[model samples]
Target chain A: MKKVLNLILFLGFTFWCFAQDHVNSENRIANRHCLDCHGQRVYSFVNPDDGSTVRKLMPVDFRVDSALFYTGAHHIFKCVDCHVPEYDSFPHPNQLRFEPMYACLDCHGGDDTYAKYHFETIDEQFQKSVHSPETLNGFTCWNCHDPHSFRINQRTGESIANTIAYDNAVCMKCHFETGSEVMLLLANEKLKPMSVSHDWLPNQELHFRQVRCIECHAAMHDSLLVAHLVSPADSAVKQCKECHSRNTMLLSSWYRFQNIENRNKNGFVNGVLLNEAYVIGASRNEILNILSLILFGLTLGGILVHALFRLKMNKRKRHE
Target chain B: MSEKLYLYPLWLRLWHGLNALFFLTLLVTGISMQYSDIDFPLVRFDLAVTGHNIAGIGITLSYFMFITGNLFTSNGRQYRINIRSLFSDLLAQGRYYLFGIFSKQIPPFPVTLKSKFNPLQRVSYIGAMYVLFPIVAITGWALLFPETIARQAFGYSGTLLTALLHIVMGFFMSIFMIVHVYMCTVGKTPLSNFKSMINGYHEAH
Candidate 1:
């Protein structure tokens, strides 16, 4: 009886594994079918009324870059997973266009697999940010983070410059005119050019290249990977010491990944930053400072003793 | 009676005075910047930066003047080291300062018309002006225009190493200045050497 039971359980497990693979394969095919029309800039169709060919340009918002989609966090998902099943139909019903969009929490909330991401906490942070739904009429996570192409670059151990560029581009999408038609459609007012707004900053170009826009604009949070609470322009940090001092915010924000990677490495004062550019006052070594102070003190003491001896000798010579 | 020699000319005196002013300005401003604290600042941060930059430029120009003066004038001859007797010359001069001066014995190497510096003075001056000064000046300029510094060097940030090198050189130069000033008093009288720099003459025994 025991032997029969074991055989049945083994077959049952094997069938379940095969079923899972089949489902995944089918989902991938479905995703490809959707991408066939969405990936291209234009698609041709037959206008049945006139029996003529019609070339229709896909709206920018409706289009998706296949390469980016495949690499994104949602690559494993099928087109109908987050989207309505009606989208799977040919000529997707016009009502599907107005279908309520899914927020990040719609799928991630209360899910054990996404618990580590602290998506709930991030949602709370976003609610308090300047870009919150309450503050802006139609603002959502999709405005800054495109669901089609968004990837985690900071923790991927890429160069800080690459990470800065990727993250800053998200803000510049709406803040500056990068010629994206979708941005113009989403924007309520004329975008304030970054160059014009940041004119008062010294070494503006260098600052932009070296750091992310969020470093000053966002409030830092120890629990979150990146700060979501965006501050208003008047509240932004302008003091040089905020970044130049030993307790710089960069250590916690921009350089956090590098810092964690190099925390155990030896032979550097500010080892994290020592691997990249050095910030004055911030990069100072405690050991070096103490050693220099000791040396200076010794030299001064030696000079004082020598001067005293010389004074005594001069007096003796006068007596003679 | 003492024999007088024209060791410092009018131009040399003027340069020496300007160099002293610049060095003092740099030292004060540099300390303020290196150990800057918002609560207890040595000098206002902005002012210190401005002062340091101006002094740095002044010192850089002064260094060029020193190089040109040494190249074109007889003063250049004093810096040339006699490699053959260098060790012996240094020992004798060192001995005089350490023991002989206390006993009122004659100096091992006296200031002469042709030789302005004793062997000990010659070596230290060369190390300061030739080696340390050039390094500090170059690194200062590199810091001012950080784009010139290599992004990385020897598996470390080049800017950090350059900054460390600059600080070390500046520290040594400060020590050298202190010693140089004190040594001036070891002449015929405590004020005699200072007077000569002022009046362009050295009184030799």
Candidate 2:
């Protein structure tokens, strides 16, 4: 009986492990988003009249056009960069340039010049990212996403680097790693900034996981501006002052606030970046949680001690 | 004492009981929702959050009901705490709880048709109704429907601020629970007020 039970338990565990993968939204034997890699044109919106989703739930249809795809300019790019080797084949290579999220890093090398002093210092922070080493793997600068389209956001004031996906779009794609699409929802709930371990894919709201690290610590690449132009007036300081208000204000001693004399073309310095400020903004609840934990532990321990000791005293008094 | 007659109104009793029940539910479910863990929730995590949301809304509704009932009815007299008598009321109640209660003496403050609650009780109820409850209601509503706050602000900065408020208010409510429970037991009988809450009547035995 014991041997049979152990075998049954083993089989049950294995079955459960596999079952969890299929339990999620995107991992069914069929789902629409898989049609991108599958190459079959008729997969995603199967039976459009009946309005049912079809197609084998293959890898995410990275290039498959969606309604909002046309909202940005870079939507015209071809399938070569994204679909990579799989631009021709079904099973994409693990190390290919188009290999899911990691491939994003391969295409956009960490050192691409968006601006003169593009933030390369984020390498260490990316290694120790909150998404690193626990639920998900530690990320390289490129692992989180490719900086290809700035239709969502351009860190620079100049229209130069158009490479950065919308924040939500970036998170949702990599949300399910090594699991089916349905598991993606569970992954999302687990990824919440205020995840309470038991919260599994909460339908509560989106703000929970929306504020990722890059949303704050975006590269504040430096720019150039002639401080005191003689012939032609410099316009760099006017533009640069927007993001660099604190530092520019501090540095411009002799320069008037309205004077065109000192054109501070510098973008946000490392110290003046709103990344830390935005991060601290999110830290309020985290700090609250820490304080709550301390209070809860103390309250529970005191209550337990009070009850247990009271019980012991009652027993002793009854004996007396 | 037999010569003096005071009749408690029905709406006051109803509003008080509903307020107490909803407040208790909100407190338990609120704590459960905030520090939600598999180890100790009185209900499942999802259900706990739902209950907190519902109970929080219910408490807000109950507060409005209580105040409305008070305003429309003569039971509003219970809220009228005199500043001059405040210290005496507290001393009387404190002394009764400390020493006089064990001697089976009369309660320090007398209950009448107009003034049912002692000064301390009136102050506590006023603070709960006007100050803590409203702050909690606004904060809880904002946190619950953060998408609205996000839209209103046109910036996402308010989400963290709202969540912080929700947690802080939750802490206040949990501490209130300790005091509320202790006060409930200090009634005519240990179970007298608890039973009064159910039947809406307490006779002087």
Candidate 3:
């Protein structure tokens, strides 16, 4: 009986090891196969009519950096998992190129594991955004976010400036210059350059460096970690007081993470001050303000008393 | 009888008037910016900022005139203090303001030709012009060009510290303006000192 048990245990252990090896081998093969074509700086092909070799540089959108992909959020996903299975065949059929792309919700939605992320709420917000499929044709989750390399940045303990740069870069990918080929492909029009559109802003460069475009452009949602409902340009926030008042919207949005981490423990009114931001009118101490007002009041009261006494004294001197 | 002395030069009078105008502008605009509310704004937000900046520049230029005038003229001598008699002089002046003035007692250290200011006036003027003004001016310029300010100092935001200092100095300056105006009423006539500032003269009774 002991000998039989040992044999069964040995067989089970071997099968487990073999399965692990096979899974790893498949991943390696898939990665190598996809990256082989997508990773090249330039793609070369024979022109069928002329029998001449033509070299063309790969577009930024089509090229994949292997290093980034292996470390990306969707690193575990095989190419066939997201792409058409028929893409496994060499010289994939031209019809596969037109296959409908997968939205983030296609895999992440309705899953118990991803429930905490509120994918449904995100979808709801996105549907109302300017980039919604009904509002802007061909716009998708992949337009702003590249699944090949998108990473969760704000919650990664990175500096606010780094997070701002990363997030703004995603917006600038489509919104930067007027006549770039990429802009034509994505926006399908000669979009106004960012510099011209934002010329009315004071300290525009500093603002761009320190803040994300979505801070002003997106419709704020209380439950959303980052607002997704991108408002139209005409509806964007233009008032300086929006971020410069005591009840600044920034504390609820761009500065939210920092405000939570570095909340003032010394009874400071504005928590954003501790994070090295001294917004005028917004970053005032309540204690100091009250003390100042009290002092001013006392001084005024003292002056009035002094004046009354002097007037009384002068009257008595005249009577005498 | 009252005698008139040319205590203020034309340039000094001009500087003084411009300084008062600019300071008032700064006071109103600065308060508006610091305590801005959307519904009940003291001044419109953008207008306050523009007005404050213009007034700030005006004050800066006025300060420069004051410094240059004092440096090249005998007016500078008025700020000098005799450290040995400082405490006693301050006490005398403090007592005069607190009690003697109301009781019709004669001023102990009256204004004179060689001594333009009383001991208390000298010390307070020195504190305001030499110490507080320089600090406020430097910090104001630093704020105007924020890139020059340090990102952090002593574990506090450097810009916050600068702004707080500016506000404190500005508060003290406001208090000084109030007391200074009231002190002018204590002259031979209530309007006599104001006339002296206008006509570059001082009246001693």
Name every residue pair that clashes in candidate 3: none
* Fnat of each prediction, in sequence: 0.36, 0.02, 0.42
Per-prediction DockQ, in order?
Answer: 0.34, 0.02, 0.39
Q: Estimate each model's TM-score.
A: 0.82, 0.46, 0.83
Q: Which stretches of candidate 3 lie over 4 Å from their true place?
A: A1-56, A65-100, A111-117, A177-180, A264-272
**Candidates 1 and 2 compared by DockQ, better number:** 1
Error of 1 at A2 (Å): 54
- lDDT for model 3 comes to 0.82
For model 1, the local distance difference test gives: 0.81
Task: Summarize candidate 2's per-residue lDDT along B1-205 as a digit string, tens digits.
Answer: 3222334456766777777778778777655544443334455555666677888788788778888887887877778878987888788887775556545568867666556677677887787676777778897897676556642132223554555555676676665666566566655555766666666655453
Can you rank all candidates by DockQ, best first? Answer: 3, 1, 2
lDDT of 3 by residue, A1-320 (tens): 99999999999999989986674566657777777767777877677789898888877777988777766677777777888888776567999979988888998899999876678888999999988888777778898889988877755666566788889999888788564665576567777888899988876876887678998999877666678999999999898777767777777874765667566443335454556666777777777889999988998888889888888988998899
The candidate maximizing DockQ is 3
lDDT of 1 at A182: 44
- Give the per-residue lDDT of model 1 (tens digit) for B13-38: 87888889989988987887777665
Q: B1-205, model 3: which lDDT tens digit per residue?
A: 6788999999999999999999899889888888877666788777888888888899889999999999999998889999999999999989998899878898998788789899988988888888888887788888877778876788677788899889889888888888788878878778899999999888985
